[model samples]
Target chain A: DVKVTQSSRYLVKRTGEKVFLECVQDMDHENMFWYRQDPGLGLRLIYFSYDVKMKEKGDIPEGYSVSREKKERFSLILESASTNQTSMYLCASSRPLAGAASSSNEKLFFGSGTQLSVL
Target chain B: AQKVTQAQTEISVVEKEDVTLDCVYGTRDTTYYLFWYKQPPSGELVFLIRRNSFDEQNEISGRYSWNFQKSTSSFNFTITASQVVDSAVYFCALRNTGGFKTIFGAGTRLFVKA
Candidate 1:
């Protein structure tokens, strides 16, 4: 079975503090993503990386940044955490779909998630 | 623009009852994918099903089923004989064939009472 491990299950940080949420997938997937979940907004993508050192901004990337220094590790960084940035953060990984014949079948395997609370 | 709407915010049902979760989507791309994900109290999003735009077949897996209709731009999920373990927040999502981003709906919380 594929395992996507998140560094922390629960975290609490003060406002203006720098925070890091780490994720590592054992499946060697080429695609990794960061998403934040809120009450009424659902899961909004913050950033994604298709390859090491490559990143793409998602729909809600304004308050977040991501780093993919290694193939298996993707980290979401909050430069200055704020109260509004508090939410459940999820990390997911998937096989590359660009050249696949049936790309629609490519689904993501997610980590347990990190519940971050900024006070 | 691509969007997914799950209008039913929450639903409650007794055990053995049936329930349906509604989903509506809007997108400009001719080729797209629709998905259903279940998030229980564990907080991990589990992929339930994925359907392409061309396929309108209604699928059933055990007591869980999905209905996809391109003409109505809706992909609905139904649970037959609801159980207490079926309680979760279900999200409907959409992704274009050429893009990497998958937009998700607000989600529907289902509670099954024993």
Candidate 2:
């Protein structure tokens, strides 16, 4: 089974504080993504990394950043936490590479998610 | 820009009954992919189905079936004889042709009663 693990299942942070959400995949997938899930807005992409040290901004990348120092791990960073930024963070990994189907059709394996609340 | 839409926000069905969830998408490109995922109460997302644009043939797997209509730009999922275990939030997604980006719909919550 493909496993995607998130560092924290729940977290609370104060405004102006820095936060890091971590995700690790055991399948050695080359593509990783970060998304925030809200009640009505669904999952909006924050950032994605297709290779180590390479990252691309998604639709909602204004308030978030990411780091990928290794192939199996991807981290999402919030420069300064805000109440509006409090939401469920999901991390996903896909195998072979991005967009190309060297293996499967690049379906994402998502983490259980981390629900963050900023006070 | 490509987008996916799930018109139904909530659906209710009794055990052993049938239910259908509707999904519509917008894009001129014919080389895209569509997907459906389920998120149960445990909060873990599960992959349900994936349909590429070129393959328009409908699919049936046990009690779950999907109808893909290219002309209407719609892909609908139906569950025959729904069980209580089928209750969850269903999301429709679309992947662009040349990008790793996958856009998801707002999702529909399905409630299967005993």
Among the numbered candidates, top DockQ falls to: 1
Show model 2 residue runs off by greater than 4 Å.
A97-104
What DockQ would candidate 2 receive versus the native complex?
0.56
Model 1 agreement with the true structure over A72-104: per-residue lDDT tens digits: 999999999999998999999888666774334
What fraction of correct interface contacts does each candidate retain?
0.57, 0.43
Relative to the unseen true structure, what is the C-alpha lDDT of residue B81 in candidate 1, on a scale of 0 to 100? Answer: 95
- What is each candidate's DockQ, to 2 decimals? 0.62, 0.56
Say which candidate scores most in lDDT. Answer: 1
> lDDT values of the candidates?
0.92, 0.90
Task: List clashing residue pairs in candidate 2.
Answer: none
Segments in model 1 whose C-alpha atoms lie over 4 Å from true places: A98-105
